[model samples]
Each structure stands twice: as C-alpha cells, then as structure tokens.
Target chain A: MDHDSYSDAYLKGVLEDVRTIAVVGASDNPLRASHFVMKYLGDKGYTIIPINPGQAGKEILGHRVYAALSDLPEPPDMVDVFRNSDAAAGVVDEAIAAGARVVWLQLGVRNDDAARRAEAAGLRVVMNRCPKIEYQRLFGEIGRIGVNSNIITAKKRPVKPTKKLI
Target chain B: MSEKKSFGFETRAIHAGAAPDPTTGARQTPIYQTTSFVFDDVDEAASLFNLQKVGFIYSRLTNPTVAVLEERIANLEGGIGATATASGHAAQLMALFPLLSPGDEFIASTKLYGGSLNQFANTFPRAFGWKAVFADTDTPANVKAALTEKTKAIFVESLANPGGIVTDLEAIATIARDAGIPLIVDNTLASPYLIRPIEWGATLVVHSTTKFLSGNGTSVGGAVVDSGTFDWSKDGKYPALSGPEPGYHGLKFHETFGNLAYTIHGHAVGLRDLGPSQSPFNAFLTLNGIETLHLRMERHSTNALTVARFLESHPAVEWVSYAGLESSKYHALAQKYLPRGAGGIFTFGIKGGYDAGVKLVESVELFSHLANIGDSRSLIIHPSSTTHRQLDAEGQTAAGAGPEVIRLSIGLESADDIIADLAQALEKAVG
Candidate 1:
C-alpha cells in the first residue's frame, strides 16, 4: 500500500472499524500534540488508552495511563505513534507485538523501512498522517474551520455525529 | 484530504467549503446564527483555547458560517486557508498584520481603489506606524527599486480598480521571491473567475467579497487567502508566523500549523483583538452570491466590453481606459492575466472635464449614482467628486481618477440598454 496517500474510503473504513486507540508518546501538557489528539479522539467517542512512561499508572482523560502497549488490559484496534521518525521504528515493533490491527504515524513522522516491516507483518500501515485530521476531513468537520478538507461530496453527512461537536 | 484528483472551478465554486448539514441534512449552507458554541466539558474547551484542536469557541475568533465562506474563498483562490473579515479594509489590515510590525514597510501599487490607496498612504502609516511605499507597479522595475531592508511584502491589485491596468504578476512575483518576501495581491476586481493571482505566484490574495464575489452589493465583507507556499521560517522576518507567539503560550504558528499559519494567526490574533469578524448572516448572503459567481462574471465581462466599446467611439468621450478594448495600452497585459474578460469596471474621460463627468453621473437613469460597485445593477461614479475627493489633484490623477475621469461598474444588464443609457447621458453632458 502507498503510505503517502490513502483513499477517503480507506481512511473512513479504518476510522469506522477502530473503536479503541492506544496513543503512544502521549503527553500531559495541554500544549503537546499527543495530549490534544487524545482529547479530540476521546471526545469523538473513541476509547483512548494513553501510553506515556513518565505518566504511567496515572489517569489521563479518565483512562488509566500505561507505560507500554503490553501493559494494556486489551490490545487497541489502532496504535497511534506520536514519536519522532527514529522512535517510530521501535514503536512499530511494539505495535505488531501488541497484536494491533493498524499502525498510524503522526504528521512529519515517516519511516519507510518501519512502515514496510509493519505492512509485511499483516498490519495496515499509514504514515505521515494524523488520525484526528483524517477523521475531521472525511466527516466534513475540518471544513467548518476553513481548512480545505479536499473531500467534495453532495451527500448529506450522517445526522448523528459520531462524536461531540458542540 | 486525498490528492487523487481535483474538481473543476465551477464544481468547486458550488461545492467547496460546503457539505450537507450533518445534523439536519440541509443541502444549502445554513447561517449558523449564534454568538458562541458549546463545549462538552472543560478539557475540550481548554483544547480549543490552546489551539491544540480545531473547533469553534467564539464568534469573534471563528464562526461556523464565516468559516464556510473562508474555506470557499480559499478553495476558489487555490489558497491553503483563508480568514473572512467585516470589510475589505479589514481584510487589508489582516493581510498586513502578521507581516509588518511597527516601523516595518511594504510596497504597494499607486493604482488601487481610492479607499485602499488612502488606507495605505494615509491611515496605516499614521495610525500603526507601518509605512507603505507607493510605487508604479505597472513597470515591474519600479517595484524592485522601491524595496528596502525593512520591506516585508509587495502589494498590488491583480486588475487595478478604476484604471483597469493589469499588473505583471509573474514578474512582480519573481521580484518578491528573490527578496525572500511574500507578494500580496488584492483580487477584489478580478475575481477568481477572471484571474487567480496565486496561480501566477502570489503568496497571499485578499478580496473585498463586498464586490464581485458577493456580486450584488448586498454584503460588506472581505477575505485574506494564504497560498501556503511561502516559507515563513527562512529569514526569521515574519516573527508572527515563524517565531513563538506570546498569547498562545509561545506557540510558533509556522511550526505548529505549517501552511495554515497566516490564516490561523489572522483569526486567532487579528480577528480576536481587532474585532472585525464577518457576521454570520453576511457570510450566508455572500455564500449564496458566490454560488452563481461564474455565471455572473461571464455576463458582467461581456456586458462591460460592450459598454466600453460604445464609450470608446463616442465623440463626447476623451479616452476610454478599459483593458477589454484593443485600443487600451494595457490590453496585452490584460490578455495575459485576465483572458476570461477584462472584468466589469473601467474608467473613461469625458469631453467637458470635471463638470461633464459630474453631469453624466447625474444624468444616467439606468445606472445608480453610488459609491459602491460589483452590483448586478449598472452603477456610475465621478471619483474626483466623491471617492477620490480627499486626494490632491496629483494624487487623484496618478491613481487614474483625474478630474475628467468617470468610472462605471457595468452590471449584468442588457448590452443595448447599457449602451443607450450611456449615450443619452453623454449627449446631455456634452451638448
């Protein structure tokens, strides 16, 4: 699969299938990227399991924070890696070991070798993408904030928002 | 956002920045008439306030309806993002707010809308201490010569307001690029239907959506679009975009938002503090107006050419300055930039000078004697007597609004009726 660009249908399918997400490199600071992604996903009805070694055994967004993916009570449907390109190589192995269905690399974090390895292991791989941004773009939420969602459709969006907007 | 394929201009015009209402399935974009939005809890609210997540928090910073308009304008202009404002002047201020600090300077074309010219030449320099160095951008060399160490951007109208002069965008863009600064184009007159300045390398495009974009003169609004191509981080010149912002806990906009830095800053800082946000209702009206932008521009261009031809041949006319006419000196430049049509507004000199110009505006029955333009109804004005009244004689003449000049914003009226009305008005004024 070309990790560079994913079709809208592919992204929507993945988002629809994933109910639980494990955010690696999650931060407690409100300004950090990982913390906001966790909050947005949690608000959007996703069961977010935040993984941060520094904040392990603590509560983040009302969910118990874990040091690593192995400590989770159950394997998440998606492993969102928020680490740098170098750290992603190690995180990809952990995601495969955790029996996660998908591995997602945050924006500006792309390791082709790691992505290929994850794909060979039968785990779906998406690189240089943010799950939160994809969810908003596909579901017509990003358009509300004046960013080009790039998905043009005349069809009415589902009356029920999958997550909270207000 | 998938990059598989792109939609055509007409399709994008109607559909871009809009989707069926997720809640009610309303096909049209409804005016989200509200002052504020509700947050689920304190965490989400904090996320919004911190710029960690993108969502509506307040009407001053962002609104649903206004956001749709901003997205649509950005889409139309091929920009990465946009911020809509209360008026075109507000848009100009927003465009310059991030790039210029106190004592910083930018170069602007002398040939511009009288209000914009005044804003740059008088108001901004006096009020904000941001100096605008006026240059005759028709000759691209003049733009290059005016640049100084303090210059942060080059500003020009794609198609000049009253004179119908076409700036050499690509040439000026190259100069701006060499200087490591952005080129700002006011695309108010030449709507995207006629020309998109970004395609020719404009880093930012501003619009008075009050004009052609709104098409009927019903709403007063403006927009600043970021092409998202310029690198704000290179020289450390634009600190507002490249450096850490104080208000958002030292958040570096270009680092945080990438291509969307300027637009986000325009809303987060410019609109929030200046309080020049576009009203939700005005945005809705402008949205509806833009749906038929392609159609109206086609008719407006054709009708304007017809009127320009008639005025060019009339014995009572001194000279016609419409770029659509082959007789115009700027005709070749117009063909290069605005091939669709030369837009709907142009200036001409009447035989009897100032009195003749004043009489013609008064004598026209079909044309509204008003200060506004881009209306569906024909409109006329004597700039020397009204719009350019504050400028000195030399200033007025240099801006292509001499004492003899009469400007007409040709509307989507029948070509024959428009010509006949001008003919009768000319005869009465000169006879």
Candidate 2:
C-alpha cells in the first residue's frame, strides 16, 4: 500500500504502535488544521482524542469531544483522519468499527478505498500522513521547527514514551 | 532514538531548536523579550491574523527567541524552515524576498561578499528593480552563460567571500535544475560547519549568522535556509509562491504551506513587509553562538589551515588564496565541497603592492584591523584599503578584491600565535 511512499520502517511501525489518538476532524477552531493537529497532539504526550461532530461533548486540548470513532471511551490506539478525501471514506469505516489499531491519514487526508477497507479490517493504514508530522518526524521532534526531519543518526534522542499500551 | 537511529551532528547542535523552558523549565533558550503575542481570543486573534494558525503575532513576525534561531539554522541547514534576519544584509534581502519580481533577474556569484558585492551591484539595483547578473561562478559555464529570460535566481558563495572561490555546487545545481531556477546558496563561508548548501543541491541556504553561525564575535544575525526542495508550483514562475496572496485572503502559499512554502512566505510576507526581524536579544546571542558549532568549526578549520600554511611559506608572500591550500585553485573544489575544513576565511597577496596592502593591515599586532569575518580573535582586512574600498578597478579585480589583497579571518587564536602575528606583520609590511 504505497499511499505515496512511507517506510521509515513503515513509519516507525505505525508511530511505534501509537498510543491513543482519535482526532478525526477535531477542532475548536484554533484555526483548525484539526485545531493545529489537536494542539500538536496534546503537546506531544499524545492521548489526544477530540473527534468533533461539531465538538461533540466540547473541550479540545483537554480532550473530551467525541462524536464518533464510535463515541470512544476506550478503543483508540490511533485513528487521526482529520476528514476529507471524501471524509476519509467514512473515517475509514469508523476506524474499523471503533477498535482502531492505527489508521492515521491527516495532512490533506487520502482514502484509497478507505485504505482498502482499513487494511481489510485489521486496520493499520496511514495514507496522507501527518501524525503531527509523523510524531515530529519519528521522535526527533521536527528538529525543533527548522523542519528537515529527514532522520540522520548517531543515536541519542529517545526518552519520550510517557505511557499507554495494554 | 533507535528504530534505526538519527540525531547526531553534535546532537543536532545541542538539541535542535532546543527545549526545556516550556515556561520556566528554562534550560537556556529564553530571550523572548516581548513585543506582542498574548492573543487567546478574538478567535486567537483571527487565527494569528489569518495565516490560519501558527502562533506568535508580532516581534516582527515571530520570535520565541527568533524561533530558536530559526529552528537552529533550519536544523543546521538540512533546511525546510528558517528566517531569522536583520543582517547579512537581512539574509540577502530575505533570500530575494520570495523570489524576485520587479523586472526579475538574479544570478550573482562574482566571488561575493564585499558587502555582498554592494548588495548585489548597488543595493539590489537601486532599491528593488531587482537585477543582479554578475557571473564568473568559477565556470559552471559562467553560470549557464548568465542565463536570461529574466533569470530569477542562482546566486552562490558556498565558501567565497574574499576569494578562495568554490561555487560549483554540483555544477550550479545542474544549472538550477535545468533552468527552472532557484539555487541561492550563500552559506556564509561554508557554515553548516563547512558547507551544507542544502547538502549540495541547494535551493536556498543563505546565512551570515554574522559569520560562521554565530561562532562568536557577538551576533549580528541572519539566516534563510528553506530547501524544502523548490517546486513553487512548477514554473508558474513564483507568483509569490504560486499566486493568490493578496495579503493572505487569497492565501495559496504553494497551495497552503506544503513543504512550508518558502519558509511560510518568509514569515508571512517577508518578515511582514520587510521589517527584518531577528532580535530576541540577537536571537539569544545567536543561540549561545550555536552551541560551539562543532567545536568552533574544528578550531576554525585548524586555524585556517595553519594560517594557510603560513602564508604559503611567506617571504613577504605574493599569493595564497587557501582552499585548504595545495596551491589552491579552489583545491579540488575544497575536497569536494569543503570536506570539513577550508574555512576560517582566507586570501593573501602582499610582497608590497598597494603599499604592501596598506602596510599589512596597518601592521597587525595580532590581527583585528577588521571589517569583520567569522571572528573569535584574529582578523585583518586591506581589500584595496578596507573592504574592497568601494569596488571599481574593474570592481576590484572582478571581486577578488585585488590590489595586493590580504583578507584573513583565522581566529581560534594560537597557531603559533597565528604564525607569529603574521610574521611580525610581514616584517613591518614588506621588510
């Protein structure tokens, strides 16, 4: 599924097995790009959530609003979407019926038959990518805003995983 | 950060664009010294004045300490973001303000920096009719026979200032990618620690973060970077980045900031209509002088190749331009684009000519007759009596500043006390 080139080890194995995302067309109008990628993925500690069917239950940076990814209270290891590309084909079928295990899509959202029906229901898709610019281009955090997060190396960056995962 | 690594370059130069003070954890980067930014209402100040979000609403178009020295010199020049200005001639007029337009035409490199050939042959053609031409780009076929059709961009200097010329960046980046135009370079004397003009393909890099990425001699500032791989909407010929911005409402900056459209239109319309920002206390002293830019460019390229092999075995010297020497004719394009060295500035000549180059920069006593160049101590000048004393004599020998040159900038000091203070200032200027 070449949704326009990926493989930084399949986007660091779907952003290192996500860790709660949701976002959908989330916004509280902080001049929406899904409210600045949901306040930059809730200021990087993730667990974001938002969703917004018109701010379903209100609240954005403090996470709450949920109108679907089947009104989540639990199931959300990633769904991102930020709708468009025909509402990311029904938010990739409600993120494979609200049990998402990755589906991403955001930066100018794409669909490809809703990413082949969310990889034939086992989820994990990604498409027009932008999990906050791929978790700041895979953890180096967009080189603190000078961009070119085209990953080089010599190690030393890690320390981020705050918590989440069964 | 293994998952197959990435971060190096001295840990992205002491942690790229920094972190820590997300409000008081303040591990350094703080000079935000106010001038606006409070918003949180009026729809976050009309989404930061309709650029539809990307915070900061002032300090001349963004500041958090000059956005961490414009994202630490766009992450030490790999690029894709950067702006920081107010010098290096406002980063070469904000890297030609989103690609010229008043009767466009660009193409520089006549071995630049005599105040960038007097701001491109007299202040960008008398304050913006934007012309520039000049070529001799050390033969990239005289920059594709100085291209025309109102050229639009090519500029160089990946290690040029004061001659030791080296622009041939992948043959003028393959003639600005087969003339689609946009090369830019100026990497202030090879400063992505000795050249990173967007790793040789260059599509804008500019600097002069007051020479050598603020490696001391207190910041004057400047940066441009970008290299978001220019496409600018495939030859629509940069209508200020593929047309539409009649002051943001028509928007369309490369169709909404894809690859951050020319560094977000160089801070929303060239530092918001040319204000030339950069002063969160000189971007916090050029971000602590770029956290020791790789140990001061390896002791300023080993004290400028030991003061260019002591003025090429001086006996009052007569020539020594210094592309890390071996009789430099840009010594194999400085070992294929500055293979880490050839950098603490160069230039020589002497054996008494223009009054022994104004008596060896008024007889140096530990250099510093300066008109400035990546300083840390040693410095000197004399270009036909001080910075190409207003060009002419065929623009000071086609900008190499001839008339018995002299230049030098070598500065992490002690290379045998900078070759015994230029050997007693060449025995009192030509013994």
Candidate 3:
C-alpha cells in the first residue's frame, strides 16, 4: 500500500478485472467532464451506475441514477470518484463499505488519508487519474495521440471486443 | 492535467495541445518525422487499426505533431475534436465527405471564396455527384428555401472572402437547426480570433490554416473542428455515421464514439483513404503561429480598420466593402459576430475600373501583388484577373469579385504606413 506510482501492469490488471463503475458526482450536463467519462466508459462496454444525489431518480446517458454508492442495486466492482478531494473521503468510505475491490479517484480528486484508509480496508487504490485515458493508454490507444506506447509490431490485427459478463 | 475550459484563449493557444515531450522533456513539440510508428506487438497494432485504441499508425492517418495542432485548433475553436488536412480545400471536402453521398445536395452561401465556388459548382458535382446549391445568404429565407429532402448540410463562411461580408450566423444557424442539418461554417478569414462559429450554433467549423491561423503564411494547412453538438444518429439520413460501415467490421461511429463521431471518422476513414494529410513539419510551424494569434489578429484588425477608413474617404476609391466601416451593409452583422474588428481582408472598387485595379496592384510597393490573403505583409490582388479569373462575369459578381474590385489583406504594419502606401498607389492608378 505504498503511495508510489502504479505500474502499467497494475493498472491494466485493475481495468481488466473491474466490471462495473459507480461514477460519483455524475451529471446530465454534456459539458461536464464526469458526463463525458460516464458516456465513454459506457461505450467501452462497462456498466456505469451514475451517482448524483441531486439527480437520483433521473437518467444520464441511458443509465439510471443512484443517490449514492449505498443506493446502488448491487456493489460495483470499482468506485470511480469524480468529486473533489474533500468529498472524495466520504466516497472512499462508501466504496469500502460497499466492498468495492478497487477505489479510483478521478483526475485532480486525490486524498492521501482516504487512500491510506482504503488500503487499510484491503482495497486497491488509484488516485488523480482518468480511467478512460488509462484504458486507452494501457490497451494501446494513447499511441494515436503520439505518446510512446512500449509495444511495437508491423502486423495488422483486428480488435476483438473484451469478454464481458453483466 | 486540468480541463482547458479554465484557461484563457491566449493561454490555451500556447499550451492546449502541447506538453513537454514525454521522452525528451523538450519544451517544443518535436517533429516525429517518420512515415510510420512502430507498434509494440501484434495485439497493440491490431487495436490501433480497429480504432479500439487511439494511436498513430501511419502519417497519412495521424501524426503526433499534427495531432497537437489539431488539439490546439479544437481548443481555440471550442470544439470536441479536430482533423488537420493538406489545405483549406481539403478541409472543406473532408468536412462534407461523411455527410454527403452521391446525388445528395447541400446549401452553400454565394458569398464564398472563389476557389470554393469553383470546387462546389464544378468539381463536387462532376466528380462525386454531390451538388452544391448556392443561395444568397444575405437573407435567411433564401437559406431556408434552399433546403430539400436531399439536403444534408448548410455551408457558409463566417466572413465572406474578398467582399468582407459578415454573415448573420445566428439567423442562418436557426435555419440549419429547423432543417435538422449540421451548419458547416468556413471560418478561414475570421480565424477564431475575430469570431468562433461554434458559439453561433455551427455544428462544424473549417479553417484555412494557411492564412491567419498560420499568421506568417509559411505553411499550407487546414483544420476541421467538430462541435460535437449535432445528433447524427437522430435521423436515418446520415448513414455513414449512424449505419454500420463495411470498412471496420460494421462499426457504427456515432454509436461508438458519441460526440466525437465526425472527427473520429474524418481521421479513421476520410484522411485514411483520401491521403490529404498535413505534414508534421507544417503542423509544427502552424502551431508556433497560433501561439501569437491573439496579438497578430488584434493588430491586423486595427490596421485593417484604418485602411478601410482611409479608402472610404479617398477620391480615387469608388466604394469600400469593409464590414468595419459604418457605411458597410454588413456593419451591424459584423459588430455582432466579429466585435474585435472586421478581420484584415476586404475589397474596394477603384475609380477607373478593371484597368485602374490592375494599375493599383502594379503601383503598390509595400503591398505584395499576390493571390494569397492573411499574411504578415500586406497583399493586394485584382481578383477578377487572378483568383477569380476563371469565373464568368456572373460567377465573378456572385463570388464578390467584380472587375473593378481590388482585394486588400491588411497586415500588422504601422497604420499610417499602410494608409500612405494605399494612398500613393491609388493616386498612381487614377492619375
């Protein structure tokens, strides 16, 4: 539970293992970063249960909203917190209570105390990172943006959709 | 990295798409000059080809340097994404490629660059079987009337070339919205510094980066910015986006990418097949030019206003068609859309006619007699004899390039120097 950088293997493992993501502070507004991330993850074949207290009964990007992580129909595999650091502590506590295997704090939403507490509860933690960007990066998508992806090959390959069990 | 919405235009222009080279820590964006990138493995290479991952495969498809330029332009224009191409003409073609198939029609403004006119009237219809019905967009009714079941998009320029006519973008956008088609605005002359077309309800914006966006005229490049607002999947009309494609295992782009469908398709399919890709070096130069866009555009606007005013008062000038001038028909529209100033290019009729227009071009010492606009150096052209010479008299007038007209692209020189140079040239032509 050291607060050092997570390796590519660790990130890729987390992404492959997680099935459902509960996006805290999700909004219906398309301009919001949370909304875009929810839509992107959903398109990538992840089950997204949007968590926004203000929009508990409504729908965002075709997913029913939950008032909080506790209100979800079932425990999410990963709790992706989009709220600020102060709000993130409460969300991290909820993630532990809900028995989420991984607690992910989105870009700029980091709290060391929360990370420590999550680790104490035996939960894997990712802080201050976007899951969508990471999924593309680890899976060889970021190479499109000119980032150096360590993998290199001359042969063309078809992308098979990742196996999903909903 | 924080979202770019918090940054100012100037700050975004300098840093939006650019970050220090991850490998070298080089502050400047390095030109990844290679034709192809080495894929890490067969699976990684397959993922890139499948569009399952976003990474460089080929230079004709995407380059890192060009990607930065695309990101910067999209940031400046307030779009979701962008695709950079070989030239402005290519950008126009790319913008319409996915939307229009054979026998489909699109409404266009008559007040467009003559080159665009030729492409739309001649090339598009003949080669692709796509027809462009030009409507006088001075009235919004004409745009609305031009719409038919076959129409897919409504195209116009924010500020018409040569004549400096500022379009009533809001009114035209309303027409485009009612018709449920994307508003494709060619913002080449205005350069986002004067106006952002997306703010006025444009679905997509195109730019001739060869002009003011490059600022120095050192490179020829173009960009297409997707607003990500239009719902291409709503109607069955846009099949290329909504329907499954044969290219990538029946992948529906709109369903897959959501807001980024058009731009993603432009990169994945349009640029991939057309091979009209901008060079990484050109993108690097254009990115450098954009850093000083705010400063250059301001000076260009102010200098243009001074020149316009001087020409309006000059005895040798018959009329000036600058939107910045109070007497211009497009003055009110210009104020609403381009409050900064009415851009740096405009046309004026000389006292004597076509011969005097030619004389004026020959007499000017400081202003370069050339076909190009939006350079750091002032440029003068008698479009009837140059850029629009291919068009007939009726076509010339429709494109706003009459025989007596002389187009001027005001530069960032001293206002007094620009005025003095024009005045001397005018006297030589008329005397």
Every prediction: chain A TM-score? 0.94, 0.32, 0.88
Q: What is the lDDT of residue A133 in candidate 2?
A: 62
Candidate that scores best on TM-score: 1
Global Cα lDDT for candidate 2: 0.78
DockQ of structure 3: 0.10
How much is the lDDT of residue B318 in candidate 2? 80
Clashing pairs for model 2 are A152-B6, A153-B6, B392-B395
Model 1, C-alpha of A118: deviation from truth (Å): 3.5
lDDT of 1 by residue, B1-431 (tens): 33456888898888888878877889998898999999877876887888767779999989989988999999999988899999999999999999999899999999989999999988999999999999998899999999999999999999998978999999999999999999999999989999999999999999999998898889999999999898899889999888988899888888666666787788888998888999999999999999999999989999999888888889999999999999999999999998899999999999999999989998999999999989999999999999999999999999999999999999998999999999999989998
Give a tens-digit lDDT track for model 3, residues A1-166: 5445666667878988998999998988654557667766776788999999999999998899999888876889999998789989999999999989999998667899999999999999999777876786455444354332232222221232433422
- Which run of 10 residues does model 3 chain B get worst, by summed lDDT? B1-10
Worst 10 residues of 1 chain B by lDDT: B1-10
Q: What number of clashing residue pairs does each candidate have, in the order they appear? A: 1, 3, 12
Candidate 1: Cα lDDT at B41: 79
Ranked by lDDT, top first: 1, 3, 2
- DockQ for each of the predicted structures, in order? 0.44, 0.08, 0.10
Off by over 4 Å in 1: A2-4, A49-76, A83-99, A158-166, B1-4
Candidate 3 versus the native: TM-score? 0.79
